[model samples]
Target: MKRIHAAPGTISPVGPYSQAVISGHLVFTAGQIPSLGSFDEQPESFKGQVRQTFANLAAILETAGSSLSHIVKVNAYLTDPAQLEPFNEVYREILGHAPPARTTVCVQLWGVSLEIDCVAELIAKENGQ
Candidate 1:
């Protein structure tokens, strides 16, 4: 069976989807944007937007009993190819020590510059610790 997770203090999904779902020991998160819990407060700059997006991702992950450090894979979408490096700068600041495997692609997004989704193991099961 699968369990759904919704982080408190985060923006609710605008569509028909849960924030994250846990099946077995894995948690799958929906693509997160840079709204920072409110569409009205979305950041304007690229790096700022990236920070907010990660913050959103982190919240959902924590709610699912996982964390950034426990992620096993990630999929990132970028509106502009030039922003990858800037995004990585923030990524390194947060998850750089032992970042999860990730695949990033350039694509067009509406109202946001980037989006991110990830798959992670529950914290208690991380590295069998």
Candidate 2:
């Protein structure tokens, strides 16, 4: 088992929690927000915020020997119900055609538009070791 700190180019966790954890073939990620662990200067647009959040998520997953394509489940939190369709647009663009199973809900997010976390399988080597 391994605990992951923030990856390069990603925001560090501001509290007492790891960015992700690697256990056997799975990687469980912490909720990723748009900022670099700060509440100031959050993206003004919903899509922009979503993109930044995913970027942070991808960085941590990669550091855990996983990629976005390896994700098996996702839990997304949105602060606005009206942004669901717009969020889906960006989600499709980034996650591609076959996205993982997901559960998204509108919630009260402090100083941010959204938060995302996921569980992903580790990418295997070509040798399948």
Candidate 3:
């Protein structure tokens, strides 16, 4: 069986998808963008966008009974390659020691500067399983 997770404070999905789905010990999160309220209100700087994106991802993971420390893999998409350095700086601060394996690529995002999706281990079993 699988469990779906959504946080009321986090941005609602813009498409047909849950914020995250937990199956077994793994939590899979949908790609997160830097929209705390609405897509139109995204941060102007790449650094700001990256920070917001990570915050969104963290919220979804927390809702799924996981955390950034438990993340095993991440996939990041950036609209510009030049944003990589700033993104890395924020990523290191948020992830801290023993960061997850990550793959980042330059891609065209409509309005946001970047998007991130991740997979993490559940910190605890639901209802003790």
Leading candidate by TM-score: 2
How much is 31 displaced in model 3, in angstroms?
Answer: 0.3
Tell me the tens digit of each residue's lDDT in model 3 across 43-62: 88878888888888888888
Q: Rate the local accuracy (lDDT) of all candidates.
A: 0.87, 0.89, 0.85
**TM-score for every candidate vs. truth?**
0.90, 0.93, 0.90
lDDT against true structure, model 1 = 0.87
lDDT of 1 by residue, 1-129 (tens): 465545877888888899898888899999999986586678878889888888888888888888989999999999988998998999999889999999999999887888999999988854674
Error of 1 at 119 (Å): 0.5
Cα deviation at 95, candidate 2, in Å, is 1.4
* lDDT, candidate 2, 13-86, per-residue tens: 77999999999999999999988556575678888989888888899998889999899999999998998999
Better of 1 and 2 by TM-score: 2
Query: In angstroms, what RMSD does candidate 3 have relative to the true structure?
Result: 2.0
List the pairs of residues colliding in candidate 3.
none
Best first by lDDT, ranked: 2, 1, 3
